[model samples]
Target chain A: MPERSRAHEWTPITLLPLNGGPDPARLADSFLTPTSRFFVRNHGTIPIVDPDAFRLEISGMVRQPLRLSLDELTQRFPTVRRPALIQCAGFRRSELARVRAIPGELPWDEEPVSTAEWGGIRLADLLAAAMPDDAARHVAFEGCDDVEREGRRFGFGGSVTMEEAARHDVILAFEMNGEPLTAEHGWPLRAVVPNVIGARSVKWLTRIELRPTASENYFQRRAYKLVDRAGATTDAWEAAPAISTLPINTLICRPRGGERLCPGPIRLAGYAWSGEPGGVAAVEFSVRGGAGWRPARLSEINLPGCWREWTAEVDLASGRHDLLVRALLPDGSAQPADPAPLWNARGYMNNSWARAVLEVRAD
Target chain B: MPERSRAHEWTPITLLPLNGGPDPARLADSFLTPTSRFFVRNHGTIPIVDPDAFRLEISGMVRQPLRLSLDELTQRFPTVRRPALIQCAGFRRSELARVRAIPGELPWDEEPVSTAEWGGIRLADLLAAAMPDDAARHVAFEGCDDVEREGRRFGFGGSVTMEEAARHDVILAFEMNGEPLTAEHGWPLRAVVPNVIGARSVKWLTRIELRPTASENYFQRRAYKLVDRAGATTDAWEAAPAISTLPINTLICRPRGGERLCPGPIRLAGYAWSGEPGGVAAVEFSVRGGAGWRPARLSEINLPGCWREWTAEVDLASGRHDLLVRALLPDGSAQPADPAPLWNARGYMNNSWARAVLEVRAD
Candidate 1:
């Protein structure tokens, strides 16, 4: 075996449902987060599937249902490589849960995200072959992994609008970074939809359904939404859109909170990203507790659906200091400064400014 | 002249162009903000409109151009009364400006909004009468007021998509609070587009145009947009969407910051409003700088496009304290606690938690 899964390094939020945050230092400095260092997020149990027998079924409001094996899917369709950053919608839930009570949610910290080159066929080409019906407005993706919510067991599933399904970057990938996806990651086949929450990037792919409305799957219909009210009526849940378009965000990696630092010039680095078409225009840091802000340089090479690395320099004194970073999107939306305003019932999409308190000492 | 036009009590942001914020204390108590206490926001000099002679033109991408007098407009169409809370997109920009310099735009505080019953003809009905062409996707509103920007004079103008134009609350108002239109308040006619930024509701209406794209007016195309970059390219501006949909916000009227009072049980009251369809579902306040947040009781009577009064009581000790309030929208979005993340180049949509510091002094 080529070493072992990077499960040990990950801080476990839950073991059975399998969600973990990666060690920030190992994952931070690199542009493409290694598969081993990538954080794992799953809503259900990982299933064992036979690669030869695995068939991705495309059905529902299409002219005809399709069941294609891995060979047929890879050989028959036009393949493309897409680089995408997958983030749990609840990436910074811990920060928000600290400020407010987001009960029942696994309090995710600043990990649950990583970038990789995914090899797949464009979902559009596959949809075109399937021939969607005129009335089909949504396309649902179902995974083989069984997820239990409220005692009933079902596959972890989600749906996207037909327009979203047709985006050039939305794909069904079987490979990550030139290697076949590991079991912890989506194995055999998986959807690789960039720019949206990772939950929509369903794994252990089994079935795809085109429908007139959104998927009735519990994950799509009830969960993965940003409803502010508790005990929301079915109508309220119906009205809310599934969380999409990752907000402008920054991931501070080098200066880990509470890490010991010398009282001198220190390197500040992280990745800035957004789902907005304008992309991340700038990433700024405020070492003086938001009293002042200075711009950080973005990586010269940047791509959509991938995080751009950012670096800056700041002088630190022998004291405790909280460094703040905010990503500015060209579309005019920026990250909020405090987590208190971003507190939600589900603790999802807490794209507030990334704040890390550091300890500067004389060693 | 209606008690000196209530101008003396208003705080002037600009003198000649005439933008002013109403006294929040006076305007806060009333559900329907009185005409005298209504905040005035103008981009250009108020023009003297001759009601009888003035012709409202509906042209461009239509079956035929129309020029109807006020009498024809009122007598020919079905008149309706609409009550909407009109808020400048830059409301609470003053708080953001303190954190970051948002040059050029007016620094409006929390007082640039008020609600009054508007009497007018439904804009949808008017468009139906004009017989818009299928190619028309937008409806442009042109005001009589002359606004000069970059040495070019253009009537203050804006455009709304046909989807927004067809909203039930969009109207051409000739009366405010049952009184005849005032010069500063869109003398003869004004477009009252509820649930949108106040700028889209062009006052002193002179003409309307149907087109395939948005208005090319300075306010519509360039201004009133959220672009985080400095010196954004023309293409960036073109790609950026104009600011619309007043964010969920709260206005804390009682116990203004820096007011001295005895430390004891104090009553807190504010108005929460939203342009979103679900409106403000809940309003919450925290006395201890966001250590915790408690719910505030919403008023019994609430209306769409109008603020709902909320009240609460908190026991305080003798010292300095800060009060923060936030409005929660049913759509799963909440206000930010700090202004840093919401700070844009234009300082628009500062829906961060409303913060007010109070001093408790022994009497």
Candidate 2:
């Protein structure tokens, strides 16, 4: 809520129940992430609303159930803009809670991802003027934030999958990085959905229904699926997978996890994506952890669901190492070399092979 | 130029015959500044033009000189935006070139200031359609690139005082913080001028003229001015003065100087300003070097030539220290507790009293 520290000073951030994120070595300094060093996941606890009395309702399986108002949803739709990359299906839940304890949530390292440019209109143009029907097949959303947990009161919900709300890069954002939308982001609306998983991009938004399934809420059926343990029940959290797009990753934002290297060359860099008919293709790097890798260079921005900005230079020596990083997917899948058999239980997508360490020494 | 490093890792920037800047501990991490960590400064090179054949011109003492283009200066005037804070009268010229040896130049350090938003068009609505001439006092501007130095071939120029170019917060910029202008900034025009001296904000802009007495080019009559030594003569730089606005400074941007601290309650933050009707008004802080200081808080924006955001907490205990900081101004003037008595001869405004150092240890 403001107590959130670590915007970068050799990374390592943790702060608040607000879910602090970032420290993929300060996300390798830039490819856009500066909304105060972006990364603050939040679930409930942050609702003040009132941007001239907000509004937005839209009712379920609609044929006509609107509500509107934030100046009639920004002067009747039509705005659009993109830039994507959202991240945060617990992006690296602290490397799966250091491989053991996933306890009461909040671990997420690698700054819950960023990349902005949003702007709004087009949740399929407000579900095509609220005529949705044909028995809607999922689109929920919610969020005026409530959060109570084992004591009842809820709010932050989610859904999607009506072909991911008729993608065209989803949207509903009310601008970000072109301003207008700051009340801890979601000043007038918020649901961007690009590349998915940033908890379905909801935030202060007030409902949106049109469903026929997939919104048994509790964070669209038990906190972003992919279960295996941590108190599951409810039929193994509705048979696993509910984490929309975002998968083939890559990160290592510079030699920054406790960095202290010396022995020559280095440089490295970070970012890399995927999510949607396979996106990022090739990002490799190793330094020993994977035994042999190399090949970085990327940056001609691959787009489709964003992220890409790599680099290389290698050549070290002196001692302590680790390093890693991975990614390749354009359907070629890659990125696995061990996340301890993809854990889960609530730590969500820990991606795997991203490592860091360093130490070198011996000028 | 992509080879420049340390944009962060606890500040200390310096790179480029292209001038980089930023390490007033990363300019206290935000209150605008970030066009890739702002603070560039370049006086030569980086000018490729073609924002669809930009133009500008306007000509001296006008009656109707004109030229315009860039879509007739955005459909003839009216844009405006503002935010300001430009800095760099060689911001702390590397602590007055480590107190002596000024030599050729570039030692910069303390990141030549930033702050943005800009946007454009109101050079008093293009000097009210190029009418000017009632013995127009001083305007000048220039730019289109060039820059050779110890062998001649110049270009970047400057001037002002047509009552600081008809105030209303100067302008002429063509957007920044909202895109449009990046060939390392200065794409289709530049000249924001607010609170002056950023080499008079004259980027790739080409000509504006008017003048009557100040700007005989060569960096407006023998480079930036101020006087007191380091290779003076041109009649002591035409008898001193020409360094426009900016003065009551203050920096520090969080612990960062040789940081290493451990002792206890540190915090401290940074940024402070004052240019025009002497703005800032209070910022203090110290830790031995200045004897006893304290008071910091600030940040309700204040605005005058901008900057603000301040903080403080202190406490310490173990070894090495230093710290400092300063400011106060709204006419109370304060800030020179020693930058070695404000050096000069091209190390322009150092302002002094900022310090840093740190190093505690002992957990």
- Candidate achieving the largest TM-score: 1
For residues B237-329, could you state the per-residue lDDT of candidate 2 as single tens digits? 876768788877888878887878889888988888867575787888878888888788765345556677788787788988888889887
Interface RMSD of each: 27.8, 13.6
Q: What local lDDT score does residue B141 receive in model 1, on the 0 to 100 scale?
A: 94
- lDDT per residue for candidate 1 within A223-306, as digits (tens), equals 888888657787887778778888888899888888899999999988888887867889999888887889997653356677
The docking category that best describes candidate 1 is: incorrect
Residue A96, candidate 1: alpha-carbon lDDT: 84
CA RMSD of each candidate after superposition: 22.0, 22.5
Of the true interface contacts, what fraction does each candidate have? Answer: 0.00, 0.00
Question: Which predicted model would earn the best DockQ?
Answer: 2
Model 1 spans > 4 angstroms off? A1-363, B1-8
What's the distance in Å from true for residue B316, model 1?
1.3
Per-structure clash totals for the candidates? 1, 6
